[model samples]
Target: MVEITLKGITKRFGNFLALDNINLKINDREFMALLGPSGSGKSTLLYTIAGIYRPTRGRIYFDDRDVTDIPPKDRNVGLVFQNWALYPHMTVFENIAFPLELRKVPRDEIERKVREVAKMLHIENLLHRYPWQLSGGQQQRVAIARALVKEPDVLLLDEPLSNLDTLLRLEVRAELKRLQKELGITAVYVTHDQAEALAMADRIAVIKEGKILQVGTPNEVYYKPKYKFVGWFLGNPPMNFVEAEVEGDYLRVYSSRIPVPSHYREIIEKLGIKEVILGFRPHDAQIVKGVGDGLLGEVYSFEPLGREQIVTISLDGVFIKVFAPEEESFTFGEKVTVEIREDRIILFDKEKEVALEYLYKD
Candidate 1:
């Protein structure tokens, strides 16, 4: 395994800049995900790392070795693409052995390695099947096996499970995570799916339009987002942003004013932020009954989401969503109280649209 690093990596296409001064590190044996939305420069960054596209500026390194000018074939990296990239005419055995064959491995050794990886991937039974003969999930395994058969120092995957059905995607995701851990390969996975990154990666570098916003563990990014965009991007149903005016230790959110949490009090006072944006996740707030530290609102709509339900409360003109059990039911215009987890409330600077740091923590 190798520690891959990109220093001030910038990729530009004519007048359009794909990656703007990106600096990231994937530690040895680490599973890191480049996460972002479509056209957010995530796939561009991955391809850059794979030596497929030369960066317009900056350098690439593999464990102190400068490989910025090296070709993709000499990078000692394996890449799996979204479409599987399987050859319809080639059997699974031949496909997996292609990389080894490129290096002139003997037929006996190739057969051994091919069968070994196929069994490891639980596709030994399908070794003779062509790409057209296998299901989506099986084809995905074959693609991954081809990447691993060479024992490449680093593995790069570009939305490898995006084409699979929901259940198959889940199955393949688990297998990939297990294989990476067992092999201890440094892996960089690029995807727009938050759940995939959160589930598989040890660390995630959240990207948006060519710039990285934050890099941290899944819990760190979710619970303590460094920017409002990160907070808004990482959550399901996203976060509810309420415009508020800070006064002393209280914020006048729309028509409801609530005292700021103790943890954020010092920052609020220090910044003397007159106008701020308050953000909290839907699951972090619960419905209460005229309870202390709660906001009163009327239910506007309720969405049933299989395992869980969401209650959209009309907080005056602004709507706030709260998580409820699937069995929980509510009526339109019904009065409801929402108690937010005080410590979990996030304060952001409205002008800069970024999170404000607390001067002191409790």
Candidate 2:
């Protein structure tokens, strides 16, 4: 296994800056995921590490050796593209064995390795069929098997599960995680899907507009986002943001003013600002039957999602979504009070769009 590092990496396409000055250190055997929306440079960063795209400025290192200028063929990295790029004419066995054959392994060794990888990926039974005859998930498994047959020190996956259907995607995701753990191979994965990254990555690097925004475990990025953009991006229903002003020791949302948690005295004292953004997750706000130390709103709509329900409500002119258990019921236009736990509140600088502090005292 090999640790990978990118230092001061930058890339540009004509007038567009595709990647900013990016730097990251990926530990050996760690499954690091690069996650962002399209045009955010997640794929470009992956290609740079794969030697498919040379950075405009910066260096890439594999373990202790600099490989910024090395050709992809010599980089000893295995890359699986988003498309299952399998040769349609070749049988699955031949496809998986192609890399070993190119490396001049003996015929017996090629057969042995092919069988081993095939079995590990649970595609051993499909070896005699061509890519055209197999399902999308099977073809993806074949592509992965071919990459693994070469025994690369670093594996790079570019949205490897994007082509599969939802159910198949989950199945493949589980298998991919299992394979990575059993092989202990260092991997770098790129994806626009937040759910996939959250479900699969050991640590995720959230990128936006070609710059790294936040890098952390799934929980950190989800619950303790450092920036407003991160809070807006990671969650399903997304975090709710309300325009509010600090009025003395109280925070005013719309016409109602609620006292700030006493524990946050120091943080509030440090901020010393009147205008701020109140950020809280949908799960952090709940519907209550009566008045409470929270905001009052009328339920606008509800979306049922299996065991949980997402309810949208309007406070003043702003809409907020709340996640609740499926058993909870609310009708359209029904009056409801939202209980926002002080400990779960996040305060952000309205101008900078950055988190200022947690609302509650530690």
Candidate 3:
């Protein structure tokens, strides 16, 4: 196990800044994921850590040793690529043993390590099969086994399951999590999938425009996002945003003003915010009968999901999605009020578009 530290890490591709002043610490034996949309520098950061792409500036440390200048093969880290990069002509055994062979390990030692990971991944029976003959999931396991055979201090996976089918991806996700916990090997995963990052990592680092936006446990990032982008980027349906005005501690959403929660009262007074953005997740909102304590809207669309319905309501001009229980039924263009959970409300500065939760007097 190794603790990985990156400080002032910056990467440039000629004129393009791939990573900008990135600073992060991945603890020993911790599963950390770098998550973001495409071209967001997540892969670049992962490659830099894997020693595949050297950063233009900053230092990288493994434990207490500086390894920024180390070559990819000399970094003592196992890397699995998105494409799996399996040798089509080589048997599973040969593919898994290639890394060991490159390091000039004895044949006997290579055989033992190769068989061990194969058995662990339940691919032992396919050791003699070539890459072309193996299933996608089986091939992915082979790729992972190849990386793990060397038993390096760090394991890096770049969208390792992106190529698999949905069911296969779910199966592999569990396998990957189980293997990481069973071996307690430090891992860094890179992907654009929010569910993948949330499900697999001990902590998730959300990156955007080559900068780290936030890093926290799944619950932290999900429940208490520090920025508007973090809140909007995480949820399955993502968070809904409304342009609101702070009119004497109350938020003016559309024509009606909603009362602000008491916990945020002191901070709201302190910040003296004239304009603020109200953010809430689809699950946090509920469709109520009357408009007594909620915002009014007409059911624009109702999507059924066996257990419940995802109801999209047209609020004046803005549309918001609400998760409704299966027992509830709504007709098209039906009017209803949405009760936004006060405690779960996320307030962001209208100008800066950053959460104000940290400014409150707790």
Candidate maximizing TM-score = 3
Model 2, span 20-60: residue lDDT tens: 99999999999999999888999899999999999999999
The segments of candidate 1 whose C-alpha lies over 4 angstroms from its true place after superposition are 290-292, 358-362
lDDT of 2 at 196: 91
Which stretches of model 2 miss by more than 4 angstroms? Answer: 261-264, 357-362
TM-score of 1: 0.96
C-alpha root-mean-square deviation, each candidate: 2.1, 2.4, 1.5
Model 3, range 177-273, lDDT digits (tens) per residue? 9999999999999989999999999999999999999999988899889889998889878899988888886788886678986767877888777
Residue-by-residue lDDT tens digits, candidate 1, 85-158: 99888999999999999999999999999999999999999998899999999999999999999999999999
Could you tell which candidate, 1 or 3, scores higher by TM-score?
3
lDDT of 1 at 25: 87
C-alpha local distance difference test of each model: 0.90, 0.89, 0.91
Tell me the spans in candidate 3 whose CA falls farther than 4 Å from its real position. Answer: 358-362
Model 2 poorest ten-residue lDDT run: 353-362
> Weakest 10 consecutive residues, lDDT, candidate 3?
353-362
* TM-score of each prediction: 0.96, 0.95, 0.97
